[model samples]
Target: MSNIKIFSGSSHQDLSQKVAEHLGLELGKVVTKKFSNKETCVEIGESVRGEDVYIIQSGCGEINDNLMELLIMISACKIASASRVTAVIPCFPYARQDKKDKKSASRAPISAKLVANMLSVSGADHIITMDLHASQIQGFFDIPVDNLYAEPAVLQWIKEHVPDWKASIIVSPDAGGTERVTSITDCLNVEFALIHKVRKKANEIDRMVLVGDVKDRVAILIDDMADTCGTICHAADKLISAGANKVYAILTHGIFSGPAISRINNACFEAIVVTNSIPQEKNVKQSTKIQVIDISMFLAEAIRRTHNGESVSYLFNHVPL
Candidate 1:
């Protein structure tokens, strides 16, 4: 709409610029600074009174800082009397802790829920995010939320880049990602496979088990996020052992925490493709086989549709024909 205004925080500025470019508009001016005590300080340089504003801020590096910037931006829009505020977070922070894993630890799902509540309370009317760690986390928000999939984008890339067209097999590195892997498989009209892993000891390698034949086929592994390369590396090893000709990976968020890059480099995968949902770390940039597939176009279109009150479902129907 003519009343739409888009802004970006310190986080994911490049992706934000691409989104703004797609909409044929300039990013709204906003200054985000750090205080002497290392606290986040944000200031809106323009007015958005009676306007629908979308704030693009993904929680990547310095996750807490990015989170605070998004919160403060929302608060500023509310105080400026904007008609509506939408938080366009490609990577939602604190998503991994959606459920409590230890008896001694407090429930962090509530913490994740608190983030949604904070945004709503601070005047966020809508949310846009991609490939949440757990799909059930959507229930944490009462406001209208649009959870976009990177599948359309990933599938398009695969169809273009992968060598063999008809013999590709979608793979899930672990049983937990079966649904995600199947979605891609169905879209590509390809058969799918699943790899199972068992963690025998802490900080130790995991043993992998294969559920389907991967031999002499183009194996494609799909997962929502890759924090550590442990599971994926193990899965790749098993796929190789099972006589898989070559393996490729499509991961939504490439967190690449710790020595994940090194681990992935040593694995049997031909290439590890990831989206720019999370900013690529320094270590990731140094890797040769790690490819970054930009989802900026997909994200940009979603933001434009959201601003114009257009249907986002069409964005996922098929990759622009």
Candidate 2:
């Protein structure tokens, strides 16, 4: 691990430190600051020439600045002749804009692809991220991209916390997440359900209908992320109205942007489970319904395996508990 150097940006320093500690190493020193004009400046404190360099920066608070800092750091490492540079972004930025749905009418740009291009152009040799909003976003990058899953850790949490797990039903808030919910239910040998939503306009959900039985059973909603929490809260209300004994939610990234915390606090869910893939301290502190699970150890293991040229496919199914 001597040749492996890990540096962190300002977005999520706590998570980076934990990941470094899990690998039995200290974080590499780097000076990062914003100028008077709010421009990012990065200076590597140590020589990274001929060494594997991993920059830990999640696209969360101050998203633009964090992203710019990561790109600049990658360029600096490459300029210094580092052997390789990997952007270890726990929560990728602009992941939701993975497609150009409306071309002529709105000129929708695939921002996810744009970010991928920026990273590549900025001297990133590899990418590491977890539970991307859209899995196909991996295809946007020409270089090697490791898309890790947070399901193993989430499943482990469910197994230990949820009583009578066999009686609970895994639910997908929308048709798009059916595959993700299926994966979790299959692992637990449990039944699963799906919620079909009808939208009147952009970001305005008209109604939601459940496709399976949740009556008298615990309903666990699973998704990749929750930004505004509007859909999640509405789904939880529907589950409760449908006579579900209890409602819970598990998502990889707890963006909790805008009014997400307020909505979640007033929602019917007993607990809103999420991984610390994004900095959620404020969200957790503000809401009694929020529960955060650390995924640093899992990420650390993936980094170790990747650095050692070992296969990380097994990590997809097993949590490193």
Candidate number achieving the greatest TM-score relative to the actual structure: 2
lDDT of 1 by residue, 223-245 (tens): 98888788888778788888888
How far out, in Å, is residue 62 in model 2? 1.1
For candidate 2, give the lDDT: 0.92
Clashing pairs for predicted structure model 2, backbone only:
none
In order, what lDDT does every prediction score?
A: 0.83, 0.92
Q: 175-267, model 2: which lDDT tens digit per residue? A: 999889999998999999999998776567999998999999999999999988888899999899888999999999998988899899888
Task: Show model 2 residue runs off by greater than 4 Å.
Answer: 103-106
Question: How many clashes show up in model 1?
Answer: 0
C-alpha positional error of residue 238 in candidate 2 after TM-score superposition, expressed in Å: 0.5
